[model samples]
Target: MMFEPFQRLTSRTIVLSQENIDTDQIIPARFLTTTSKEGLGQSVFFDWRYNTEGRLRNDSPLDGFAPSEFEILVAGPNFGCGSSREHAPWALSDFGFRAVVSSDIADIFKSNALKNGLLPVEVDKKTHQQLMKTPGAEVTIDLESQTVRIGHDWQTVFEVEAFARRCLLDGVDPLGHLIKQLPTIEAYERRRDEL
Candidate 1:
């Protein structure tokens, strides 16, 4: 899926400091019936967002915060640690998060997130602590420089897989990136056929 190109993002963060947040917590298993990415935003953290009676929870971390105001989610360590579900990132993306910052993100989850246009930024423990402590702090994530900066005070480098970074920079998923090279691929095929 072609998504909004991610070059540089500067926005306030939504901090969810609870560690070991699995895919089920991100999007409960019961809500995974639909394959559509749309409308899943409502189901993102559904259990936490609403109570048993389907009412919004008063103590939810996301309470009183508009998703539009926060593009980055500074989550606790081991974010997205459970089963490999693309739905996790889908729901997050639909819910308006462009990136998830953490000390350590699960490998499968991170791969799925990157493919789905959700930048999984793994920072050092100190940086993660700083982010977790300061809720609603303005931060900047620059994909080109591979750096995450908090104003002029703190800045740190993060690593993303080279191909994934390229895809994110161009705002294209893996398939989309391959599609863009079709003409060259066709040319090569034609030459091989001629030979």
Candidate 2:
């Protein structure tokens, strides 16, 4: 699969201000039955966005905002804190979020996200509050510089592992990247056989 490079992204943001949002809440367990990533986007944050009757909640934040208008999510502390399911990141990515900004994120989730080509950005509490304060604001995430630009003249730096950063900037998943180096691997093997 061809992954999109995440160098610089400037798009409207959606803030889920509540803390400790888990994988189940993000996509729910019932939805996890499918191995395919397709259609998972529609179920993202499914429980929160719907009622018990499977009807769209009148007060759903998703209803208030179209997915096309936003590509970034500004979430509260301890985001992605539930089960270490890879589907969570897949759901988020399928839902049109290229990156998620939070004050704190679960380590396993962060690693899963990075592998899936989703940038998980951790910012200071102050910066997180600032981002939440301006929901729908156009935020710019510069993966190249490892910074999130909030509003005019205000920006905060984020940390991503160098290898993960390289993968994201290059738009290649780990397996895909290794696959792309097949020629070099073959050449090395041939040379070793001759020796």
Candidate 3:
């Protein structure tokens, strides 16, 4: 599927102020049985979202954002810092998070997220603090300029790899981007055969 290109996103924030939120915590090992991403959202952060009785926790940020669709998740430093499981990003995307803003993100998780149409926007510590300071604040992410605008007066630049940025802006996954270049690839192959 051609993932929709990300340009500008304006949404309320859900603060997940936990550091080193590994893939297992994001989506436990037990929930990884499905080949399909469908229904994974329900299991995203399964342990934290539910209590011992399998009830939704009253104070969980997932609970607060569940009723409403919050596009941005402002997480603590070293977000997604566990095993390199593609399922983590799948679960987050399935959960309807468009972007994850943090001070840092694990390399593998960041790559997976970009491939799956989830923007991992990294900002400075100060910016992260500001975001957490105001829960439910409206945040704007501009992919074109690679900037995250917190409020009317506060804006911070975030870095994304050039190729990944292009993919996101074009609304195409990496595979889709390669497929679009099939004609060029074919021509190059034919030229090599002519030699």
Candidate 4:
């Protein structure tokens, strides 16, 4: 899937300062029935967003905020830590989150997120703490510089895999990246056949 090209993003953040937020908490296992990525946004954080009767909880943390208003999710440590479910990132991306910021993100989740065009930004402990404390702060994520900056004073660097960064900058998934090389691949094949 070709995602929106992520060169730089400047947006208000939504802070979910709960550690060990696993994939199930992101998108419950029951909602994983369909292969489609569409409409998963409604079910993202389904358990926390609704009651047993399926009504929106008045006291829910997300009650007052709009997903479109907050594109970056500042999560607590060990975010996306449970099963290696790609659906976690799928639901997040579908919910209009372009990036997830944390002190530490689970490895598999990071990989899944990158492939799906959801940037997982791993920053230092102090930076994460600062972000957690400041809810709804406007931040800038510059994918080219691998930096996250909050206002004129605070800024931090994060790391992502090189190839994944390239793909994200180009707005292509791994498959899409490979598909772009088709002309060269066909030329190589033709040469091999001639030889």
Off by over 4 Å in 1: 176-195
Q: For each candidate, what is the lDDT? A: 0.91, 0.88, 0.88, 0.91
Ranking by TM-score: 1, 4, 3, 2
All candidates: TM-score: 0.88, 0.87, 0.88, 0.88
Q: Write model 2 residue lDDT over 1-195, tens digit each, in one string.
A: 557888999998988998998888888898888968787888898888888998888586656667878989989899999898899999999888989999999999999999887899999989888999998988999999999998798888999999999988988778877888999999999999999
| Total backbone collisions, model 3 | 1
lDDT string, candidate 4, 125-186, tens digits? 99999999998999999999999999789998888899999989988779976888999999
**For model 1, what is the C-alpha lDDT against the true structure?**
0.91
Once superposed on the true structure, which residue ranges of model 2 sit more than 4 Å away at CA? 176-195
Which candidate would rank higher by lDDT, 3 or 4? 4
lDDT tens readout by residue for model 3, 13-112: 8898988888899999998778787778888999988998999886788776463458898998889988888889898888889899999999999999
lDDT of 3 at 141: 97
Range of the 10 consecutive residues with the lowest summed lDDT in candidate 2:
58-67
